[model samples]
Target: MSRREKDQLHLARINFLNLIGQSNPSDAWKLFCLVTPNITEEQVDDQAETSSKLTLTTIPPDVVEMIVRTIDIESEKNVRLTAKYLKQIVDARDTMINRVHIHLCSQTVGIEVHEVTKEEPETYSFNVSVIPGVNHIDNAVKKFEEIISKPNTKINHLKIDWVRSEENRASYDELLKSLAVSLADFVEKVHVEELTIDVNAVEHLENLICSLKPDILKRLYVIGPPTCGNDKFDFSNIVILPQWKHLSAFTSSCCELICPIHHLYHISNLRIKMASTSPIDIVGYRDTLIVSQQRIDHEITISHDMENTKQMLEPYIDCSRLTTCRGYYIRSNEKRLTFELKHNKIIFSTMQFLM
Candidate 1:
């Protein structure tokens, strides 16, 4: 074959291989040799480089993401790390890399792990140790404060897992108090879109939520049971800031869900799972009330019977000021009701009232 003809064949093979590699790397490797007949290893490498450059230039960014996502993270981490074009594809999309997970093993050993599946073998893990003879609570609080102060990092989600620690239970309360203070302070400055806290320490959870200013927290999820103390737990003291839009609670105690809805009027989305079957009262603006209630294994029943439960909701519904509801039934034979109101009319009425 002529030199020009051979070059054209090589380019074709290169483009074909690249397409397959992006779509299915394992399959691409299996068929690599058949398409590039008599091509040496060095020639194949050069062709791949040429094809990568061409792909980067010609393909739309979103299309490149589809190709990058096809590769398994654990198996192809090295390949992704080495290829500039592939790395760009992974970074452009908000895949797994943007999140950080912190697991508290014990007072002595704590593990912070960050995994991004889009990047090849680019896993980052940091281990934080408590100062010897010093308080682990202090160390955790310090680290948390540092994370909150950094403005450039987009840490919208935080997960705290407290691994069972027999040795650390003695000082758990002090540690929890410190952690709660830090969390409460953090929420004030940072836009915490989602928070997941798993600790045996219930006091910390209460303190953290109570201390939080609530203007910056858009969503909250507390995982654990409520604490029993000398004083009765007053759900009213727990303030639900106007900024809170989504609230979720997983507690062994059924009563914890009642306070947030009864006092906090701004939540638009709410999910709560409790140990027992108890009647729930939901109150909110007609435009922003979306509630779902379910039992452990039994059916979930959602009521649009806002008027039946609370008289205040009647005026909001009658005037057409508040109007949107969506409920989902999970597991049990339950009824769900949803409503949507016209906001334009509500706005006009409010303006007229002001005049």
Candidate 2:
């Protein structure tokens, strides 16, 4: 601020405090308006409509933001309620908040707050008890909506954990619906992380998960038996099928799926608790053309050591269709890389792929 602004602000504070200490809120607000006389919102909109050319710097946006950031969170709402000028600051788009966690419970909604320190990852939690008529999720979302309406506000990570309660199934589902909708426009949606939940939301998770764009979803984990004796919840309906187009990874305790041959390009990993009990033929392309020096017919598999395995896979990658080292017949494709661990060697051949 310039010398004139600094002096005016100092004098305004002194006079404002005197009136406020005398228990005159109205006079204090009036004195505030006298000092920071602002043009009406209608006038701002009118100018924008009247002018086709307007650079971002036309308004000192940075300075306005710096002035608004001086208000503390606890007092921000009060300041908004007190004066029209302060309300504009609160309404400004760009949430200064960086992190938020919502914990959904049967009878309470808890918000987890992590401190600025990163060493121990210390966290503190505040909870709002569920009210009978009011929806917990809707109420919780109010804070988010108020801040996120700003064009620049970002929600870093939204971690929602649901503990199933039969008595609160309806409410739990409601919570999921609200969260899914509110986060529809969320940025940074592609972050991958393990998520474990068994709740009312599980019953229709497929639709909710599919509603988001392909890249918005991350790795997923589906645990069985979210509710008491409800172990029969169909994991296949939710995760095993190719529902969300390109979810990076999916793990389910109670479901197993024939890895989608055509959709392998979209999925990174599909693991089932029962997969070990069955043959693991992941990313197999029966008719896929093997691409090497030439377009040759071969199969592919995943391997940790593609270098050492290269000796075994050269014929396959080269479309030789025969293992030069072991003299074993091999089949392959350019679209699929198949890895097989046998006799301490990486093998790509199977009975079906052998010519």
TM-score of each: 0.43, 0.41
Which candidate wins on lDDT? 1
Model 2 ranges off by over 4 Å: 1-100, 113-132, 147-156, 165-170, 181-203, 210-213, 224-243, 253-261, 273-355
List, residue by residue over 114-158, the lDDT tens digit for candidate 2: 322222332333244455766556777665454445554433344
Positional deviation of residue 139's Cα in model 2 after best superposition, in angstroms: 1.0
lDDT of 1: 0.44
TM-score of 2: 0.41
- Residue 26 local lDDT, model 1: 64
lDDT of 1 by residue, 1-355 (tens): 5686656656655654665555556666666564345778787677666525334333444655464454444452323222344444434543222344555555342435342333333322334345466555566567656655553233456666555456645455555667666766554444444667654544455576554434545556665534433333333344433433344322222223334334333333344432212234434433233233321111122333433533433433232233432122222233333332222111111111211
**True-structure RMSD, every candidate:** 13.8, 16.0
* lDDT at residue 134 of model 2 (Cα atoms): 60
Screening candidate 1 with a backbone cut-off below 3 angstroms (N, C-alpha, C), the clashing residue pairs are: 77-120, 77-121, 299-332, 323-340, 323-341, 324-340, 325-339
